[model samples]
Target: MSVYLFFEKKLPFREKKRKVVRWIQYVIEKEGKKSKRINIITTGDREIIKLNKKFLGRSYRTDVISFPMNGGIEIEGEIYISLDTVTENAIQWGVTTREEWRRVVIHGILHLIGYLDNNRDEQRIMKEKEDYYLERFPE
Candidate 1:
């Protein structure tokens, strides 16, 4: 299992490589999925918006997007996170930027793990899963 972290906008995120990878592994294994390759890229709004338009046909900014690239059992995907949106969401939700960032990261991973939030019920369940994973994450 490998979780690769990359940066484009150089956001002020307090994450270490080892710890973040372990946290990702914990979530994946607990969800009954094995990750062979996972890429987490942190960028700004413009880049994510471009991806949203190109791949998803949405011309708006989003916090994160997950693209599953696996054909077998192992999970392989790319998660693009927009730090600008994450920051704004943190302020809007009255949480620290780091906290919101963590939530978004897990949210993307859950998406790659077959979770959805297209409706109210799915959003609630997804939020509950995020809360469960975040509460159990080792700080």
Candidate 2:
């Protein structure tokens, strides 16, 4: 299993890279799935908005957007995140940027693992899983 993270904007912090990769690996293992490749791209709000409109037909900005490439035994996907949105959300939610960033990354991974937040129940369950994993993530 391999995970790669790319930055399309200024990097947020220097210390969280290893932790983020470890967290992703943990999430995949916890879900009983193996990852062939997982790519995470961190960009700005404008880029994410463009992606949202082009791929999802939504004309608004979002914290994260995921694309699952394969549906077989191994999990393969791309997770796109907007650092601008994440920072804003972190401030709004009274959490550190790193914490909110981790949450968004986990949310994208959950999506690749077949978790959806399209309904209230699914949203609740997804949030539960996020919190569960967040609690165990290393600081």
**Which candidate ranks first by lDDT, i.e. highest?**
2
For model 1, residues 1-139, the per-residue Cα lDDT tens digits are 9899988867676677788889889999998999989999999999999999999999999999999987455899999999999999999999998889889999999999888999999999999999998887677
List lDDT for all candidates, in order: 0.91, 0.92
For model 2, how does the per-residue alpha-carbon lDDT over 42-135 read when each residue is reduced to its tens digit? 9999999999999999999999999999876689999999999999999999998888988999999999988999999999999999999999
Worst 10 contiguous positions by lDDT, candidate 2: 9-18
lDDT of 1: 0.91
> Per-prediction TM-score, please?
0.95, 0.95
How well does candidate 2 match the true structure in TM-score terms? 0.95
